[model samples]
Target: MAQLGNIENLIAARELLTSSLEKSKHLASAIDKTGRKLEEINQRLPSLEAAIKTLASKCSLSEIGRHIDPTVGPAAAVLNVFDAVHMLEESLSADPCSNLFRYLSIVKQLEEALKFLTDNCGLVIRWLEDAVRFLEGNAVVDDDRYLLNLNKCLRILEELRVTEEHSLLSGGCLCAAYGKLESEFRRILMENSFPLPMASSSVSVGEQACIASLPFPVPVIQKLQAIIEKLTTSNRLEKCISMYVEVRSLNARATLQALDLDYREISLSEFDSVQSVEGYIDQWCKHLEFAVKHVFELEYKLCENVFEKVGSDVWMGCFAKVTVQSGLHDFIKFGNTITKGKKDAIKLLKLLDIFAALNKLRLDFNRLFGGKACVEIQTRTRDLIKKVVNGASEIFWELSVQVELQRQSAPPSDGSVPRLLSFVTDYCNLLLHDNYRPILAQVLEIHRSWDHAKFEEELLSHEVHDIIKAIELNLETWAKTYEDTTLSYLFLMNNHWYLYKNLKGTKLGDLMGDSWLQGHEQYMEYYATLYLRESWGKLPAMLSEEGLILFPGGRAIDHDLVKKRLEVFMDAFDGMYKKQCSWAVSDKSLRGKACQLVVQIIVPAYQKFLQTYMPWVQQEASPSRNTKYSAERLKNMVCSLFQPKLGMYGSNTCTNMMGNINNAAINQLSSTPAAA
Candidate 1:
């Protein structure tokens, strides 16, 4: 009986164990299915979350919070349901079945929430559109309508902040509620409606500065030539080239902005009611044009001096306002908001560079070989340069008309507005290279052995050659695509400058010496001391080493390197003075007291400049102390002969008149202002 019972128990126990193993397999399958479903839900969350953000962005908080439903607002209702469902699910999720049940419920809830935001809350977008439309059409200058309306929309978000049952939802509610407010704030800021006031309040500081608003307007154009000396490394070349292009672009943009505005109206009184500087942007541009241009020019000139290119855009936005000059009649002021983003604006800027180069080319050519060659070349080159200029100038009118006509007309393509700028730039490059190539070749030929090496290095370097080839290959794509004809323009003028320096720095002054020195006493007054003026009245530095040797001047006393033939000259004029003929009148003060030789020549030579510019000297004393004391003592001794304020280097060309004042002012400020 016991054996029978054991066998029966073993069989029953085995069957029970098998049944338990089957149940376990079925449960594992169910769990795997649940995990797959959860995985799908997880994947759906990102898409649904993105949709929520999109909808939220479309609507204002008021639209989301202001529920038309009589029971509760959608935001409030969604919050309540999500919290209640979530809390109950969390509290009951103790076993596997409970966890699965809660997870399924949460997934359903999330789907519903995403649906509400996407489908039902499109009204939010409509509401936002209405708000934007209302503001755009009815925006008034100096009025707070935009701000007040924005704030009203923001206040409605308070509904989203209050939690019906869960305090935890309160923070999230507030974040969701004010999200539109934050978006609107950002939008307003971007539009410059309520400008975030800067902490320093130094916007007006640079408004009075002046700079050339030309893309390639180099205040110190001389410095840029040094970089081409010996570029051995490709990286350095790339860096410098990029810097050069960027600086060139910036200068051109600044200059173009300064030139673009019609300064017919606007004045100092405009700033009073202007809460957003953008409202009175014209005025700001006018005021800051000075400083902006100065900053632009200064940076560029510094880069030029450093023989590097500068393309720093770090402070571009911050100093955007700096480029607008408020108090200018001649130039257009674009307060510092620069626009290099647009391809058209950039094209226009390049045209300006070409224009500036042409002008400089013309001037330098005229100055270098003034009498015959300049006149002859001017006749040839002037027409070509003029055509390019005219073509480029037409772009502004063409682009404006294109934009205006686009609303009614077909969107222009190859032969339309897009390529109109291209036509202009192309023509400019053609004119520059075609007729100007000879000039550039001549310029290259004129340079010494040292210069040939430099030109070869810059133009024929392996990297630059590759760059040039690449640029040529893609030339058709650029609106400004043409051969680098500006090199002709630059090279011609560069040669002219070399010749000009040679001509002006040599015995060319000797020709005029006999006829030019009659009015010498006028300029000689500044040079009674060693202020470095020539006998005919000119700054000693203005003369070349060759010319300085011909006429010894004051202020600079560095001895020339002894020539190899000094012994021959020494033997020739060993006793030429004949000291017995002229008795020495020993007067201690005469060396400094008598009129300086440079003053005599320069004063008379620049009678034209002096006549117009002499009266504007601000400081009565000499910039150098020794000059000042000597001037004062001389003024006392020969008060009748010496004019108090007038002197050489007192006046400058209109093209760059203010730089002189600024340089001296900066010097004084650095040296004396602090002490004072």
Candidate 2:
């Protein structure tokens, strides 16, 4: 049984081996067939890739065609690309301006076609370029059918650009569109732009707030921005910008005109006097401030809003052109006119006002005209500042010249402060006001810095010192006019006292320092002392006891000599009282002090002389005739000195009384026996 099972197993094994051999044979045949197919495919791969690239290029054309006509099949569209371009050129050649949107659509289509040609037709373009180079005698290239077709397409595009009628479809159409847009931009700006509410003298906060807001409505700005974007895209933005500058510049000028600042028509001849020029200067300051603060500021904001999409350079340039054309040049020119006009002392203050206005607005100038396009405006503004500074300096120094020219030969007989001194003090006071001190100081500093030694110190003190010195010299010159030594002293005293009192605690005083006050006080005191010594110093010596008593006779006084001395003393006192009573002491305290000094010096000497001599005179027949004034009466007379002389009504009474006293003294002296 084992043997028989072994035989069967061997037969099974044989059948299995047969089945495996057949399967292996089939696998070998399939592998051989697949390897042959792969070899065939590998040999055709290059041509297949070329066909795919050609298909892609055609698909690109189909994509463009789909954008134009959706019903066309891809193959038909690719075949009709040149025909479609030619049809678009013909459609665009008609009045493209009739329908701007339609015109823009055609332009966009051309642009798309141009992009497709540039991207996919590089080889064809290179061939054409070489052909052109060949035509230009640079090289030669063999032509083919493919090159010819592409050349036809390129020629259609070139016709759209070059043909007189169709050129409008390309750059000319867009230019016309932008030109219309520019007109629309102008209309929009003009209609929307209204003059800001202007204050005649100053800009109120409300008006400033209004000016700070956008000049145009949001819709208008958006419209302008849209037009600007179109122009920018078409590379024709300069026309739009120029139109904007022109319109806004006229608007700015109109705004100034509304403020009554017709600067261009203003002539130097109109300002015939300092007063007339002063009125204009005030207007100039107000108008300039308004122009800078409101008009130019509005223009700057308008530029920023309209050209926001454009660069800062574009906005800044536009703003600068508007500012220049908006009468800023004429405004500064008017200021220059004033500076170049006749130099007057009062012009100094007006020029200083202009300087201050410009100085205050300097930052605004730099902000508005900061670009290179507005360099001339900036330069003119700076030059105006320099002119103002120099003009102010010239006028200031002329104070001294005016003083030197004041060659008055007679001082005021009232012995009060001189008119020149008063004017000078008042002028200096104005110059040293808080509003004008720093300005004048800066003017003086700049002037001194240019011509004088190199020093960086405060110049107001030196300037004030020079002016004071000139005034002092002038006072000395006038003081010499007084033939009365006493009156001259009194004149000096009054003026020096006035200077000290006027400038004691003011800005001028601060500049003059404490030494100035002390020096003037000393001058007043010195003048007072000299006035006393010259007027009444000899009265006491006239009645001196040394002359009354003979040297060899001990205690033996001459009665006749004593009486003669008394008569001479009375005559001298009467003359001095009559003369000095007319002179004025304007200040109450100064008058009292002067009266007291005269009393202290003259009264005691007169009283003591009377006390010593009246005894000898009483022995005469009638002492009453000799003693005309008692000590009490003499003190009263001394107290009455230095009071302003009576007016016309009181003068008659004083003159009659003085005449009666003189007649009584003369009768009594004549009636008395001759001294022996």
Number of the top-ranking candidate, with TM-score as the measure: 2
Error of 1 at 71 (Å): 28
What TM-score goes with each of the models?
0.18, 0.59
For each candidate, the alpha-carbon lDDT, in order, equals: 0.30, 0.65
Prediction-by-prediction clash tally: 44, 0
Pick by lDDT: which candidate is best? 2
State model 2's lDDT. 0.65
Question: Lowest summed-lDDT stretch of 10 residues in model 2?
Answer: 667-676
TM-score of candidate 1 to 2 decimals:
0.18
lDDT of 2 by residue, 1-676 (tens): 1222333443344343322324334433443453344345446545644543454445443332223221112212222332333344444554533554455556555444433333323323333443333223411244233334334544533433233233345465434444566666777777886666544446633234443545688877877887787768767789888988888898777777776766545666766434455666777887788788888988998899889898988998899888888888888988888877666555677889899888888898888887887888888988988888887887676666666566454567868665456556666767877788887777777777778745343556566667777888878888888888889999999878877877888777777889988899999999988988998877877777766877676777888888887788889989988988778775667888888887778778878887877777888998977688987888788877666544411221212422322222112111111111
Question: Cα miss at 56, model 2 (Å)?
Answer: 29
